[model samples]
Target: MDYNLMREFADSWGLVAMALFFVGAIAFALRPGSRKMADEAAQIPLEDGRS
Candidate 1:
């Protein structure tokens, strides 16, 4: 419950960890063959329950 301690952690290792996670997420989203999955997801609402 100490604001100062939390702030210090976030200013160092926490920041690095979050940055790495963001980069990894970006890499995964941009990987090859992702477009087809993204397009299918984008069409879900228009399927009209035709499944």
Candidate 2:
């Protein structure tokens, strides 16, 4: 494949693919029952040796 063809495909479809992935990631993060897990992760640094 030539550079022009590859560049064009990346310029168009690559942008679309990246945008869709971004939206899907945002949706996953905002879904129900995720807040508790996020909060627990946030406290890891402050927690002691206790597991």
Top TM-score model:
2
lDDT by residue (tens digit), candidate 2, 1-51: 999999999999999999999999999999999999999999988889875
lDDT of 1 by residue, 6-51 (tens): 9999999999999999999999999999999999999988888854
* TM-score, structure 2 vs. true: 0.88
- Give all TM-scores, in the order shown: 0.82, 0.88
Number of clashing residue pairs, candidate 1: 0
Question: Each candidate's lDDT (Cα)?
Answer: 0.94, 0.97
Estimate candidate 2's alpha-carbon lDDT, on a 0 to 1 scale. 0.97
Give the count of colliding residue pairs in each prediction: 0, 0
Off by over 4 Å in 2: none
